[model samples]
Target: MSERTKTRRTRGVLGGRSERVVLEVLGATVAELAESGYRAFRMDAVSATAAVNKTTIYRRWPGKALLVGAAVEWMRTFVHDVPLPDTGSLERDLIDAFRRRLGIKERVEGRAWARLLAEKNDPEVDSIIGAAVEERSGAWYAMVTRAVARGELPDGTDPRLLLGMLGAIVDAWNAKSPGRLKADLLEAAVRTVVAGARSGSLVRSPRRRPAPRAG
Candidate 1:
C-alpha cells in the first residue's frame, strides 16, 4: 500500500495510451476466450478485435498464459475496482450490488465468460481463475459484514449463507423466468433473505477449533 508499490502496480496495470490498449486487449481477450476458449484462443483474433497488432500484444505479454491470465485478472480487477454500494439498508445494498454486478457481467459477455471458467486449460490459468474468484468472494462477504456491522443484520448471521441463499433464489428465479431480473423480483429476494436472517433462520454457530495433537 506504500506509494512506491502503488506506483509500480499502476505502471504494470495501466498508464497513458497504454492503458487504453490494455483495457481493449483485455476485453477482446475475454470476448475471444468466451468464443473460442483457452485451448483455441488465438492472439490474431484478439488483435483484430482490439485493433492492435499481434506483435504489440506479444511485446506486452510474451506468452498466451500470461496474456490470458492478465485477462482473467482483468475481470476480477474490473469488478474489484468498482465502489461497493452502502445504501444504509441491507436490502437496498444487496439489490444495488447485484445490479452493478450484473451490469459488469453483461458488458463482458458474462454467460460465455462464465462458461470459459469451467473449461479445462493450463494449470497456470486455473490458478489465476481460482485466485480471482477467491478475491471476488471477499467482496460479497464484505457486503454482508458491512450490513451486520451497521446493525441491519442480527449477530450470528452467517454472511456466506445469507449471500448464498440470496444468490440461489435469484438464480432459481432467473431459471424459471428467462429474462432480465425484474425490480420486483430483486426486491422480493432481498426481502425474503433479509427476513429470514432477521428471524435467525440464517444464523450459524461458530466453528470449534480442534484440540492440538502430540507436539
Candidate 2:
C-alpha cells in the first residue's frame, strides 16, 4: 500500500479505538456520578476512573448532564434490538427479551440510571432520561404489538402501557438497591406482564380526569 493509503488505514483504526475510549469514559463518569451525586461530580474523578485525559471528556460532553445523557443513550442503544427468537410461543419470546434487556440494565449504566431518575428535576435531564427509556423499550414494545396484530394478544393490548409497567418494575427494584438490579425481580415482573397480556387483563384503562371543584 502507498504511504497515503497506509496513513488513512491507521487513522481509521485509531478512530475506532477513540470511539471505544469515549464510551468507556462515559460509563466511568456515570458510575462516578452514582457514587457521588451531581454536586460532587468532578472531571478529574471521571478522568481517573476512565484512565483518559480530562480534555477528551470535555471534548465529547461539555457538561455533566450532557456526559451522563450520552452514557444513558449508549446503554439504551445496547438494549434496543435484542435478537428475537420465534419459539412459537409468546412466553418464550418474552423471557428471552426480558433477560436480554435486564442483563444490560443490571450492568453499570443501570445503577447510575436509577440514581439519576431519583433526582430528575431539570428539564434537560428529564428529556435525556425519557429518550433513553423510550429507546430501550422500543423493541419489546414492537414485539408486543406484533403479537397483538397476530391475534396472539388481545385486540386492545397497549404496548405503551405494558412497557411502562415493565420499566416501573425495574426502576422500583433499582431504587431499592442502587448497586445491583435483581434478576429474580426482573423475571417475575416479565412473567406477570406477559401473562396479564396474554389473558387480556393488562389493558390500558383511560385515566379519569379530575372533577372540577365548585368555586
Candidate 3:
C-alpha cells in the first residue's frame, strides 16, 4: 500500500465498508487476546477469526501492540456506557458500582480484563489496563465530588483515596471468599470509610510541634 493509503487508514477516513471490516477485526482481536493472552497472541489467528485477510489488519494496526491497544480501547468504550447511579447517597452509589463490576466479572469482557491483569508485565497491556482504570474511576470521582457538595463528605476529601479504599476492600473480599459478595459487608465497609471521612478521623493532620530541648 502507498503512504497515502496507509495515512487514510490510520486517520479512519475509510468508507463504511472498510470501517465495518476494521470493527470486525477489532472484535476478533479482543477475543483472541482473551483466549491466547498477550504472550501467545498471533496476527494470523486474528485474521482467520475476523474472516479478513492479514493485510487488512496490518493496514489498520501496524503491529501487535497497536492492535492489542486498540482492542483494549474498544472494549473500554463498549463496556462502560452506562452512567453510575445517583441515589442521593454515596454509599448506595458505591454499592451499585461494585455490584455492576461483579456482574462484569461474569461476562466475556470480564474474562478479558482478568487475562489482561494477569499479563500486566507486558508494557502495552499494562498501559492499556492503566488507561482503562483511569477511565472507569471517573465515575467514582464524580460520585465522591457529589457527596462533598451534598455535605456527606468533608471539603478537600480525597476522592481517589476513597475509591481506592473501596476497591481494595472489594478485591480482598472477592479473592479471599469463595462465593458472592455480601451486600451487608459492602455497605458496612462504605459506611466505615464515610463515617471516618465525615468525622475527620481519616484526614491526615500536620506534624505536631516539638517541645524545646531541655538544656
Which one is best on lDDT?
3
lDDT of 3 by residue, 1-215 (tens): 99998987867765677778878898888788778888888898899988999987888789988898888878877676567889999988888888888778767677777788899887777776777766667877999889989978766677888888888898888777634888898888888888777764444336343332232
Per-residue CA lDDT of model 2 for 1-215, tens digit only, reads: 99999989877855687867976797787788667755566778899988998887787788877887777676656544445556656666766765555565666665576666666675766776876556556756777877777777776678888877887887677668753666677778877887777766665557443232232
Q: Which RMSD does model 3 reach against the true structure?
A: 7.0
Whole-model Cα lDDT of every candidate shown, in order: 0.77, 0.70, 0.79
Which regions of candidate 3 are displaced past 4 Å? 1-20, 36-40, 114-123, 126-132, 176-179, 207-215
Best by TM-score: 1
- Candidate ranking under lDDT, highest first, comes to 3, 1, 2
**Candidate 1 has what TM-score?**
0.74
Instruction: List TM-score per model, in order.
Output: 0.74, 0.65, 0.72
Q: Which ten residues in a row have the lowest lDDT in candidate 2?
A: 206-215
What does candidate 1's lDDT look like per residue over 165-193, in tens digits?
A: 88888777766764588889889889988
Model 2, TM vs. native: 0.65
The alpha-carbon root-mean-square deviation between model 1 and the true structure, to one decimal in Å, is 7.3
Write the number of the candidate with greater lDDT, choosing between 2 and 3.
3
Clashing pairs for predicted structure model 1, backbone only: none
Among all windows of ten consecutive residues in candidate 1, which has the lowest summed lDDT?
206-215
